[model samples]
Target chain A: MKKYKCIVVKSQTYAKKAEKVLSHNGISSSVLHCKAGSVSGCGRCVKVEEKDVDRSVDILKKEGVILTGEIYGL
Target chain B: MDYKKTVYLDNAASSFPKPRSVIERMNRVLNENTANPGRSGHRLSLSASQIVFDARTVVADFFGISGHEENVVFTYNATYAINTVLRGLLRRGDHVIISDIEHNSVLRPLVAMKKDGISFDIAETFESDDLTVSSFSSHIRNNTKMIFVSHASNVSGAILPLKALGDLCKKNGILFCVDASQTAGHLPINIREMNISALCAPGHKSLMGPQGTGVIVISPELNTEISPLVYGGTGTDSLLDIQPYVLPEYLESGTLNTVGIAGLAEGIRFCMNEKNAISSKISSLFSYAYSELEKIPHIRLFSPKTDNVGIISFSVDGIDSEQITRFLDSEGICVRGGFHCSALFHKKALSDRFGLVRVSPGVFNTKKDIFTFIISIKRLKK
Candidate 1:
């Protein structure tokens, strides 16, 4: 199991769309139903590697995935 | 002796007892594929994303919204989908035309938009396609930007001449949008042949999906760009301060109900599998219910005499709609009472009162159910 960082969003739809954008671009990530809302407002989040956070977030934003907050996963 | 069994007749509202596949699919997603879609780079996330995409394809194809899957945008509900089209497409000073018997979903949005400088005219629905089309044509003006209508009336079970309206709009270069909340899963709607610009529907109703899921299928030829109603993290364009100007994202904002959508996809699949059987079943039931109800004296059928969807609205002589509904409720029959939430329909339906009892059947219903329902209504007359 690879340690991953999490980017959370309120909308499960956005979360799903964001995952597709990252995958289409060859980014490694997974969606989770964790308490990332403690960091972001949404309960749904996508997990990426900590080192890949900046790259993933940038691409997601550029692709128009609405994000709330990004946090390092435990 | 009256059997103690609950009969559901409010399929016009959120459908009851969603197909087994719908529930199973939803549970599988929640338990196994619980990844936050699209935002992830992991396998689970990607698979989850696939689920959402597949759902879009299912809905898009279901309505004949061809070309791309992204053209089908999901919303919170049909009302939200309608608002996305109304609030997004219509600008200030734009005018709209609609059928007289529209659900509150259309009327309420137009009302809210009125203050913003947009106006609307209501076209009376007629038995003849030419008459209905002319009724809408008579309201067309230089400023008329769109013709919006419910594909089938929730109150009257009246099916609109959507194909005719679509043709009229194409000839005039005006946009045509339909609220298919009542008909999406029940009947076939091909966006291309109909020349419709947008078709909005709820996943919960005819789609046989869960509540809180809806979709707006856009035609590829549509030139006008509609804005989204809600805004937040799209997961793709996280860094952009403005919402993404893309196919689905352009109209969608914030987190969506993925579980609901997963359920909706299965619901649509269930409908597709049983399409012929379901349609014929509804047709048979409608005809039977209509003929049976007509035989009972004092029952006034408000629905048009022509072919209709499963929805049937009527009032009994000297009996309040709610009172009749209550009597039926006590007999283990469930039907909608009151105005069904459309003030305009109510105004046209019962000027003396605010509501009518509506008996809407679903694919799951049996002929016996309608028979029991008729017996309950006959009891009211006695």
Candidate 2:
């Protein structure tokens, strides 16, 4: 079983954007629904392999994608 | 109705015969799936969400929004977008500056907001860029928070100095907004380059998209300041009692017109493919029409000779503009008549007595169409 890390974002818009930017940077990511109580307002997060988490987040942040919460293992 | 026989000169209102891609894309969306975007996590819903996101990207790139694609908020039309910015960003004590030639969309909302303690001043527009900038400068007050103006007059097609106005706003530390009702897609506009804090435009007009589609692109500086005019379920924030503070979803509350937005993306792509050729064609047609229309004895042209957006407003010495429009309609020529929902422009032009006849040429129009329109107008009785 391959574990993944979820990066919570502001909304679905940002999740999708982050997913696109990460893909462009050769890091594959998928958008998933954030579980209850994981985030306060936005309920969407971009999921990536645990190994690719740091690179994916750096790409998203540099591209102006707003990440709402800390990364959590899923 | 023989469609091909009639010439359409009302492109400024709502462009006819949208790009085949727009129609095809819209039909494809309607036929395939009409699922709501940003809702369920199912395949159909995700596809719909992708379609809307793609549109936001295209619109954002087209308007120089750069990386902040979520800043694009879809609405019903330019009026709705303008109202959103006007009502969303403006507070009770904040004053706004608008141009004298603004459409009723901008004027009426500011007037209505007056009762709410918000105030606005009208800046006179002149043919010279210096005089126009000076006029806007003279109207700026200590409380002037935003300067909202149309990129061009919908009636006279007079193009305003957007870059100059943007610079003035930057100097004054005021937020700048544009109502690109007539100039969007027809003219080149970069929100970043123009220092525009917010831009409002209808996708149906120069954008060549289906009706019921419009966009308001906000800069990062003014994003949180603008409150949502309509608030409801935003998919992600449904668990909360109040609306989400996130962008786009924050402003877009109801179900979006997925099909319209799908077509709007194609429409913007069509404009991008056509490039400067579109403006060139409109300018050529306008010049031809102006040269011919001025030849008529009683015709008085109101549009600027140069730097116009392909719109020509004219009137006979003694005949009502609507009467001439009716005559042209009888000749199978289509044009707009009356006040054009611009009371200030009409009042300023002193054509309020009977209004002016307006003909706006689009990229699809030709010199022959202008000649036909000119011939039809020449046949009118004074």
Candidate 3:
């Protein structure tokens, strides 16, 4: 039972686009409250399992989603 | 080492590389006089009010409105100016006639007021050919209290025939309001000759001024009293809690964008000084781009083939406008995509997709930039 939290940096519009890209790749994830330490404000963040983090990042990058910084572990 | 340069082709949205004078004047205003315009009798306040008055004169002269500094009311933006006129004038059971190419700024407010019993009709534009004034005259009804139209299409850069439509409005005795958001600085607009009762313009776009600066030029004939959108202190009627019943002070409540107004005055001066040169340059660029774009297969152009302001809208086959824009962005070419706030016009034009790629050049743009753009589009085709 591993849990991983992914921080989505960017606008809600971009976050929604990222969510669709992840779902299209058959990845399951839940968005969490956006934490600061990035570009300020609650833009959006996604929480996923520790193991699936690497695969999700790869998919997002390939789909042209700009990821600023990511936080691991909830 | 030259850095990765970015080319701005979004002048229609708002101009970039504003004239040196515009920037200089704005900086001067910020440093010197930052007081509330027309509020106090002190030197700083008087200086600030003078700057705003200068801007008012520039607008009045540019638009051919007959008035002193009092008639030009400062607004937040063209949208606010339009909302002021539409909401202020239109009453229950009154009707308005507008063009299909109106921006959401005009349409949204009118639509919201529709619930209050105001009705409106849209005149269809000739998408295949040039839209003429005759097409507009047919839509006017006896109940039509006002006729509003955009001077140019934000989506296609198609210039409307304002003078002809103005004549028609004059003959029928309908109050004409023009939204000059896309054409005010780039094109020559004479409010009197056009029979425009109210002219609304944004200083940020073609005027090359800072944002939050807008103007509403009221004609002499329009006697209808317009209530202030936001009532507070107009500096004129300090004693009365009610908004003052005057020319500009009636509508302009609270502090104005003085720094932006200073910049606008410079921008307008630059426009007047280099009117022919700038317009010819923009016209040539449009022609060049249109000819170059026509050579590329599967690229559908939305703008007319004739010369116009530095604006163009087109679409590539089987490619989404957003994706093309992204590709262009990667190449350091800036362009605008999506509906361009004219969904109704898009629907009427039946543009293959819901949106089009808009390329609007500015005074700073050169032939080399347009050449690079054409080359980029050609490469994208391959």
iRMS for all predictions? 7.9, 2.0, 21.8
Between candidates 1 and 2, the DockQ winner: 2
Residue-level error in angstroms, candidate 3, position B74? 1.1
| Runs of candidate 2 exceeding 4 Å displacement | A40-42
Any runs in candidate 3 off by more than 4 Å, and if so which? Answer: A1-74, B1-4, B127-131, B352-354
What is candidate 1's lDDT per residue for B1-382, written digit by digit as tens? 4433778889998788689899999998888877776565567776766788889868877878633576789888999999989999999999999888898889998998899999999988787879999999999999999999999988888888889899999999999999998999887899999998999999999899998899999997898999888877666545457776666866766656778889998999999999999999988888899999989887788887676878888888777888888899888988998888788777865533736889888988899999999888887787
Ranking by DockQ: 2, 1, 3
- Tens digit of lDDT per residue, candidate 2, span B252-354? 9889999999998999999999978997898889989989888888789999999898899998998888988899999988899999999999999999998
Q: Which model scores highest in lDDT?
A: 2
Candidate 2: docking tier: medium
Relative to the true structure, candidate 1 reaches a TM of 0.83
Question: What would the per-residue lDDT of candidate 3 be over residues B96-160, giving only the tens digit for each residue?
Answer: 98888899998999899999999998887664333556667777777889889998899888778
Ranked candidates, highest TM-score first: 2, 1, 3
lDDT, residue A45, model 2: 87
Off by over 4 Å in 1: A1-74, B1-4, B351-354
Between the candidate structures 2 and 3, which one is better when assessed by lDDT? 2
Model 3 residue pairs with clashes? none
* DockQ (CA atoms), all models: 0.08, 0.56, 0.01
Error of 1 at B183 (Å): 0.7
* Superior candidate under DockQ, 2 versus 3: 2
